[model samples]
Target: MHVNARFWDRLAPRYARMQVRDPDAYERKLAMTRAFLGPEAQVFEFGCGTGTTALKHAPHAGHVTAIDCAPAMIGIARQKAAEAGIGNVEFRVGDLADMPDSPGAYDMVMAHNVLHLLPDRSGALARVRRMLKPGGVFVSSTACAAGAPRLFRWVAKAGHALGLLPLFNLLTADGLRAEIAAAGFEIVEDWRPEGGRAPVLFLIARKPA
Candidate 1:
């Protein structure tokens, strides 16, 4: 389910504000990401909207390649990186489904709030896995189907009924785990933050060493 750029470009302001509103969640994911990455790790961050998480962790990784589909968000992300004087990061405008031809090129790949949005998640995970170096890690977070907000789910259902949002299966953690395993990734660590109206689950999986 590739979302149109308008959906994101229109929400860029609110999207950017998420960094401030949910600093703890972002920081937790960032800390987990750092723990998984080696000093010389080459990282690729998919859907790095406005560079919120990218800018936060780019300095810690050896090199950061961040990609996004929305041009407005990309512009913001590039500017954010520049203002931070970060020199080791590259930004691109593209979808995760059409990733570049660079197999086993990265030591880590990140996809915060990106997985469930894909209709072909298994295929995409396979691609991401291929992009990893031996023992490389894929650090990510998603709204676990079980943990998704009831109100939001009802809203989504209504939207789907009203032709607003597309309808797809609500994915649970088990579903995600199976997908990752099918993509040949092994789960290394997982977390579901406890203090939230709705919990956001994060996972760190690694390509076999």
Candidate 2:
């Protein structure tokens, strides 16, 4: 985890720039996520790189606590939030498991594009489940690397071996949904936006009320 944090800290600037690569697709994600949000919602987003998505979510949510393990990423997120005059978001450098707050504190928990990279996907999902209010949503977008072409999977493996990529769990879309369900969420939206070479699963799952 420390190594992954350092890697992300180093990549913060470039990653922030890369956030704009697909404006339409990014907006679509925001739209889909927003659909589950309410004006009084309290949101927590893990692996919130550079805070772009958090800032985007702030208008619809009452408060947002966005966290990243990388200090550099949090620093950038704070700077961006300041520049945007966004007051609803509190950017912090920490992981979900280490957050000092109590469980069932948030109306929504988001883990976009970060689930597949975690070493313990089911454990993380379970933690997120415990963090939400009953009926609250877990909104996530994950790259289904298990559905990727063999060549792409091989390249990802090579990158991991070289320590250039974080751990990949290679979960398929169905597998991811099953994991979420097993974690006690009721799957709501399971979608894949068009265009990416690899399948990218966008899901909205709710903790039973």
Candidate 3:
């Protein structure tokens, strides 16, 4: 995770400037996520790049704690929050592993466009499960690239080897769902947006009450 921090730190500025690739899809995700939020909801978001989603959800949730390993990203996120006058979201520079355990601390936990980057997906899922209250929701949208063409996978691997990309787990959509279930989550919503170049799975799972 430390090694990946440097990669994200360097990319933070450019990443913040780049527009969302698919605005409609992004909006749909926000809408889906908002449906689970209430005025009293306490939320935790991991890999919260630039805190855009956190800020958006802050008004709907009572509070949001969002974290990323990259200091630069968190710095930008804090700046955005300040600019937006959004006080409910707390942006921090640390991954889940660095955070102190607070069992059942959050009503909802989100990991958007991030799960596939982790070296230990299952381990991270376990931690998320432990952090959420019973009946809490776990939301994630992950790119499942194992179905990509062999040549594309080879190029991606080569890019990572050359330090052009962060560590990416070649996960399949079904495989991700299975892992979530194995971690004691009962999936309630599973949807894929239409007409995407790559397969991205958007899921909402609940920790059994």
How do the predictions measure up, each by TM-score?
A: 0.89, 0.94, 0.96
| TM-score top scorer | 3
Clashes of each: 1, 0, 0
- lDDT for 86 in candidate 1 is 91
TM-score of candidate 3 against the unseen true structure = 0.96
Model 2 C-alpha RMSD vs. true structure (Å) is 1.6
Candidate 2 or 3, higher TM-score? 3
Q: Indicate the worst ten consecutive residues by lDDT in candidate 1.
A: 160-169
In angstroms, the error of model 3 at 160 is 3.0
Expressed as tens digits, the lDDT of each residue in 160-180 for candidate 2 is: 889887777788888888888
RMSD of each: 2.3, 1.6, 1.3
Q: Give one digit per residue, the lDDT tens place, for model 3 in 126-166.
A: 99999999999999999999989998899878878888778
- How much lDDT does each candidate structure score? 0.80, 0.88, 0.93
Best model number under lDDT = 3
Q: Considering lDDT, which of the candidate structures 2 and 3 is the better prediction for this target?
A: 3
Q: Give candidate 3 misplaced runs (Cα > 4 Å).
A: 162-164
Candidate 2 displacement at residue 23 in angstroms: 2.5
